[model samples]
Target: MTVQFTPDRLAHRDDPEVSKITAISLSGTNTERVMHIVVDLLDELGPQTPAELEHVYRSRAAVNDWPVVAFYSVHKRVSQMKKHIGIVAGTGVREGGAERVQLTTDPLKAHGKITAHMQGGDE
Candidate 1:
């Protein structure tokens, strides 16, 4: 579905000095963890370009001492989340030529979505 949103909305939220999430408290690889982070970010802050997702995610990940570098780049992870998990869908309108994405209200359970994302072979 297409959506038109103000780029101004991207700056609507400020980064917190310390992330509410305690990295020492969570389990999973950096890839798994950041996936959770991006999903929650979109779910909370709404549709955002991949660049916007990186800005907030890296900042928050830093505060938690969670290494942001991983097997998949942040941009790729965002695309994977949508292409594989189905938790977030593209808004269909680029925020000034860059792709923008938002969360999907998939009735499928989280585990179900994840299972699909983890499947072998190309989709």
Candidate 2:
């Protein structure tokens, strides 16, 4: 399958994760917050499906003491990020019937500064 991402073929735009991001973060815009998590996850853990991301995100957020968001919200945010920022692409692999996504080679946009709870570098 080897899914390749292009501007015309995006993953998740116009999703509610945008608004959820707004509610969750006090600083930065919705896009900034989503990019922070999505980019950081992919950068740290390699490729993962949105579901995998959600699970990992939940775990990381717990360990890091951050607010927990839903898997569906993660699913929508990952898709929207793939569309708006072009930071992620489908990996053509399915785990639990969902496409695995990976970060692109583009310059890193979110350095995880949007998160205030992340205190240590152990993450």
Best by TM-score: 2
The clash count of every prediction, one per candidate, is 0, 2
List ranges where model 1 is wrong by over 4 Å: 1-28, 70-72, 106-112, 115-123
Candidate 2 lDDT, 1-112, residue by residue in tens: 2332322232233535554444344322333455577777788888899988888777777677555553465676677556644567898998899889987763343343
* Candidate 2 ranges beyond 4 A from true positions: 1-31, 106-123
As for candidate 1, its clashing pairs are: none
What are the TM-scores, per candidate, against the unseen true structure? 0.60, 0.60
Name the 10 consecutive residues with the lowest summed lDDT in model 1.
Answer: 3-12
Global lDDT of model 2: 0.58
Q: Which ten residues in a row have the lowest lDDT in candidate 2?
A: 114-123
What TM-score would candidate 2 get against the native? 0.60
